[model samples]
Target: MKSMKSVVPHLSFCVFLLCGNCLAAPPSPEALDACMRGWADQNLFSGTVLAAQDGQVLLHNAYGMADYNAPIANTCDTRFRIGSLTKGFTALAVLQLEEQGRLRTSDRLATVMPDYPHADTITLDMLLNHRSGIVDHTTLPDFQTVRRTSPCALARTIETFQSLPLDFTPGTQFKYSNSNYILLGHIIESVTRKPYADVIQRQILEPLGMHGTGFEYYRRPIPNMALDHTLENGSIRRAQDRVMQNAHASGALYSTAHDLYLWDRAFRTGRLVKEKMRQKILSCDAEYRYGWATTEMFDRKILAHSGETEGFCSTIIRFVDDDACLIVLSNLEGCSMGRIIQSLSALLFDRPYQLPKKAPTGPQASADYGAYVGRYQIKPGFFIDVTTQDGQLYRQATGQSRLQLHPESKDTFFVTEADARITFEYGGEGQVARLVLHQGNRDFPGDRL
Candidate 1:
C-alpha cells in the first residue's frame, strides 16, 4: 500500500491498496461548523447531523430554526418525523412477538388474518421482505380518489384489503410497498389485542427509554418538534401538514436526534432484536430487506435506511462491525442535506463519501444503454430489469411496475423517491459484468445474469 498525492492538476488516480493506506482526514471542529453554517446560509442543509465512532462523538449539531417563521432555533432535542425509519421499530416488535412464541417468521399470513384474501400464500417473512405480492393497497386508484375528502381510520384501511388477492406469488421478488408494514402493524394489533401505540410503547419506546418518540399526525402539537418544510419556488414553507390517511406504519413516527441515536445504539448492540434477527433486519434483498438494506464500504458491512414524506427526510447509517452510526433528520424536502451529512460522516471516518455524481443529461449512448437493458441479480432469487424509454432508464423487478430512474452518470442512476441507486462496474472482459445497488450507504454487488 502506498499513499500518493495527486501531482497532476485534475486527471487522477492516487491508488491505495489497503485499509491502513487510507489516512484519516478528520474535519476540524471549526471547519465542520463553518461547513454546516455555509450550508444553512445557502439553504443547502437545514437539519441536524449526529455522528459517533469508537463510542466517541465527533460531531453533533443542528442548523437553522425548528420553524422558519418562529425564532426558535433547531436543536439536538428537536423532534422530526422519522418516516419509514418507523419500519425498523415495527420489525423489532414483530421479533419480540416471535421471541414470545406468539408467532414465527414462517407463519402464514392466512393464519394470522383469516380474512386476508392472499393470506394462504403469504408468510411472515414475505411481509417483512415486501414480497407478499399484496397490492400496495395504499396506491390503488380508489385510494387517492375516494380518500381525497374522507380519511379512513387505520382499521378500515386494513379491512379494505381483506378481499384483495396478492399481486403475484409470495417470496418471488422484491417490491417496496408500504402495504407490508401496515399489515405488520395490524398483526401487532391483532396479536396483542392492544392499540399499535401501546404495543410500540411496551416493546420498544419504553424499553429503550425513548420518552420523546411516538406517532403524531400533522396537526398535532409535538413538543420540541421541528416543523417539516419544503422549498417552494425559492421559499421555504411548512410542509408536514398533508394528511397521512392510513399510512402510519409506513411513515408517521417522529423522534428527536437523540432518541434515534439511542435506537441505533440498541439496534447495533442487539438491545432490540436478538443477534440472528438483527442480521435478518439488516440483510439486503433482491431490492431491499426486512427493514435496513445491507451495504459494503471498503469491504466492511453496513446497514442503512432513509425516510421521506411531503416535508421531511431522514437517514440512518450503521457500521455493523464498528458499532458506529450516523443519523440525519431534515425538515425540508428536495435538498442535498442528506448527501451532505453522508459526506461529512465519510470524511470523519476516512471513508469514500463522494456525492452521487450528477447525471449526464440530454443524450445517451446506444451500446451503453443497450448493455444495461437486461436483468441483473442484486440478491439471491431477485433481479432488476434495466430498461430505457426515450433514453431514460427505468428499473423494474419481479412483481413490481417500472419506475423511472434518474441518472447520476451513464453507469449509475438513483431513484429520487428514496436513497437507492444502481452503478455498473465494468469487467476486464470489456463488458458491463456487474451492477452495484447503492442504498443506505452500503453497496450490494449484482452480477449480470
Candidate 2:
C-alpha cells in the first residue's frame, strides 16, 4: 500500500470511494480529545466549529474566549468577524441585480462607473471572477497602518489602489483582489442609490432572515464580538492598530455559526439565490468562482471561501452534492483556520490521498534549487522570498517571521501558512525570471532581481 511507502500516502481509489460513503461514525471522544489537546498545546486553534451533513448537525462546539482578558468562554452564539465571506453576500447582491434586470455579468465596468480606472477594459464578470487587473487597494503601502488609525472611506481607498498601474490586462488570469468585490459593493450602491449596508439589508439579510448580519463598523454595537488578537514579537496583543478599512466587499460582517447555518440551508434550498442563479454562481469560474474558491475533493465539487482581517480569520467549506459543510472562525490575526478546516474535511471525508513514497533525490542540482530562490512581488507592497533551508524550499513574507513552503511536486511550492502559493517561471537563461503567487482570484507577478 502507498501508506507504507510515501510520507503522504495517497488513499487508494477503492478507499476513496468507501470513505466518501462512510457513515458519520462520530469521531471517538478519545481521538477528539487528543487532537484538541494537541492543538491547544501548540495554539493551532481557538474558535468554534459547526459541521453538518445531509442537513443534520453533526457537531457544534466553541473554544477559547470571546474576551481573552476576562477569559469568557466562547459559545456557539459568539459572533466573529467573517472577513471575505461577506463577498458571497456581495456576489448575491449583484446577482439579485441581475435578477431584477438592473445589471448583467457581461456589462462593462465603464457603463457602471465611467470614472473607474481602466473601466473600458474591465467587465462585471471580471469583477465577479476577480480577473480584473485592478490593483488590490489593501496591498497599498501603509494600508495596515492606515486601517489602524481610522476607517478609510470607500472612495478614497479605491482611488488609492486604482492609481497604481494594473498588473495585467483584464480576462488574462485569476488574481484575488479585494478591490474587485469592493467595486461590486460600489456598484450595488450606485445602482440602488443607497449605502452598501442598506442594499445588503434590503437584498439579502432581510429576505433571508439573516438578522445578525450587517456592515456595522462604527455604528452598530457588536454583541458577543471576539476582539482580534495577534502574537507579535513573542507577545499576544489585541490587534487594535490595524484599522478595519470599511471592508464593504473585502472583510466586513459579524455572524454566528447559527446564522451561517441558515445561509447554508438557504443556499442549498435555493432561497437566497434563485436555483438558476445559484447554479450559475456555483458553477461560474469552476476553478475560481465569484466569491468562492473551488476544487474537486474526493470526486465531489467543493466550494470554499476564507477571510482574514486585522485580528480575525475565518473559513467556510461546502460539498455541493452531499451538502457537507464546515465553518471555522477565529478572533486572532494569522490564524490557520483554512488549514484546520481542510484537515477536518480530510478527517470527515477521508481526503488528502496519501501519495506513494519515493526516495528523496538527494541534493537536488544547485541550478535547480537556484531557480526558486528569489524575491517575488505579490502585489506592489507585498513580497515573498523563496529560499532553500536544509535542502527544502521555504517561503517568507515581508512582515511575517516564519518560513513555510510545502512541496507541491518538485519545482512548485505551496505556502503552507496562507491560501497563496508560488510557482517560479524560468526564462531561457535557466534562472528564475518571474514568480507567480496564486491566491484564489488574484495572482501576483514578480520579476527576478
Per-prediction tally of clashes: 2, 18
| Candidate 1: Cα lDDT at 225 | 81
TM-score list, all predictions: 0.71, 0.72
lDDT of 1 by residue, 68-187 (tens): 898678998888877778887887888889988899989998888887777778898888777888777656666656642355677777766656776777888866677788899888
Clashes of 1: 2
lDDT of 2 at 8: 9
Q: 350 in model 2: Cα distance from truth in Å? A: 4.1
The candidate maximizing TM-score is: 2
Please identify model 1 stretches exceeding 4 Å from their true place: 1-24, 27-32, 145-150, 160-165, 282-287, 351-449
